[model samples]
Target: MAGLYTDQLKLGLDDVGWVFAIEQSGSIVGALLGFWLTPRVSWRPLIVGAAFLAAVANAFTANVDGFAALAALRFASGLGMMVATLVSACLLARSPNPDRAFGAGLTLNCLLNAVFVWLMAKLLAESGYAAAILSAAGLFGLILVLGLALSGDLRGDFEAPPATPESGAVRLAAARTGLAGLVLFGLAINMIWVFLERVGLSNGLQAGDLGNAFALGLLAGTAGSAIPFVVGDSGNRARMIAITTAGLVAGIALAWWATDYWTFVAAVAILASVWNMGLAYYMAMTAENDPTGRYTRAIYIAVVAAQAAGPAIAASLLEFSHIGTVFAISPLPAIFALLLVAAVAGAPRVEGSSLAR
Candidate 1:
């Protein structure tokens, strides 16, 4: 939402980058808190409290007067949302089909984002920025209510495994590889994503056209997330990751070569879809590696940190080089990360496959 209204927020590119960095920094902190609390605290109250905190933080954004205030509010919102997400991930990791569970979560997220993006665009056209922000706040408030209504037995389903040094070492090593891959994958996606609007405008696409394309891209992402949900982990995940990485590179190439609106739309759609698909696979892989939710929290932190770094690094590169150079450099990390995960995946499974208990 903030990305769509830079003019109204009176923010420069540097300010925008700082805001994102600050927000993600808060998530990293929240992930750390989740890491500590996941085993010690009950999941039900934690998720509900996190959602309420996020809702209150975002609701307060309506009164923000300057970049400082806006950044602070966003930081609070990120912290709350990350904690809620981490608790949810812990529960999903315990499900019968972790891949399908994660995919379904991603699908719902993408669908809601697509709908909200379209609604926000329309709302911004007819109303003030406060109304758009408050609408988001209202949605978070609804999530809080939903969280409250979940069964108390949900927390009982997760029991932290007693740690032994030999098993812990193996699990940590595998989880480390998955975390590395997810960091690079997230970074590569966001580097191009942050500048997509500029790319479209340079190619003669109008603002409205860009908005429509982004919403459509998110909808396409919903479909991509559904792939794992429907298929239910039937194939080799390493091969799927390889295919998705290639698709990410192809999406970036398409964007670089696009000269027309339809081409740009296609590029964005492919990128968004591929990103979500890759994320579901990555999340499932990490969850399988570390069922305790310790490294899972670490994975969340690394991913958010990469997301914060991607655009800042790209912006820095743009000062000295072309956007094409940034594009060329983006996928290299993903390719390296893929190799790391594949190498670890080829090893014997220490834990059972299918995330079955």
Candidate 2:
């Protein structure tokens, strides 16, 4: 949508960052509020209310013109989306098998995302941006309905018996490490992902072709996220993150080198697949670090902040240097992220066990 928004509003590529940054600002605020309130309130109302808010905001988004109005609407939408998202994350974090739970959730999400991207492409082509935005609003409306139907009553869900002092200190340290890693991981992925359509267009691909590529790529992402669900908690989480990160780096490199459409499609597939796979492992690791879901709320904050920063940073790089430079530096954050998390929770340590020394 960033690409399309640029064309619709006649914005430069760097302006895309401003849009994402403004939206993410609302997410950061919502995440902070969720972090503070989850321990005090019920998740059901929060989710339902947030969904309604987002639905309304997105519905009105089609009627707005100019960057400021669009940003304001998107910011409202982001705020609602983030609050709902963090509540869901907290619930998943408290699950019996957090790894498999998060995996299943992401698998379903990516599957839906594939269809959403395709639909957005078609809607924008046939009906213009308003229809696409209205469709998003409609989707949020559906989420509001689902929240009413599916969300259980879970007050005091964040309450947990305190760990012993010795163990508590260790878990806190490890959770902080993993959260930092998550920040980097989120930054790296979104930086490239937000610009992916532009990358393809620069290489002579049509919007429809890129749309098809994204759809196929996100289907691969569904499979990638599902691997953890299939493997369950028995699989090595840190090792999985490392492998997926390596694949992501390779895909980024390949995307930079790709000249042909098929080659670009292959790169998109790999990039989408591995980053989503990596996300499951990252979230699972953070959840494993803290069962109480307190830190998990912080995960939303860290991720939202990074998601905001990634585009701004990438946009800056694009402004100051070549796209090649953006590609060159992009993988470094992911590499650093892997190193940070693996240092604390490397292989040979099973899930829910104390972080490896």
Each prediction's TM-score against the native? 0.87, 0.84
Clashing pairs in 2: none
lDDT of 2 by residue, 1-357 (tens): 566666778877677778877887898888998898877788788788999999999888777768888788889998999888888887777777777888888888887776787798789889988898788888888878877875567853655445666666666667777788788887887788777777778878788887777666667657777887887677776777788888888888777776667777788888877866776677766776675777777888888778778888999998779877788888888899878876776434443355523
Question: Model 1 has how many clashing residue pairs?
Answer: 0
User: What are the RMSDs of all candidates, in order?
Assistant: 3.2, 3.5
Candidate 2 error regions (>4 Å): 1-20, 65-69, 120-131, 150-152, 161-163, 194-208, 315-322, 346-353
Q: Write down the lDDT of every candidate, Cα atoms only.
A: 0.78, 0.77
Off by over 4 Å in 1: 3-18, 66-68, 122-129, 153-172, 348-357
Q: What is the alpha-carbon lDDT of model 2 when measured against the actual structure?
A: 0.77
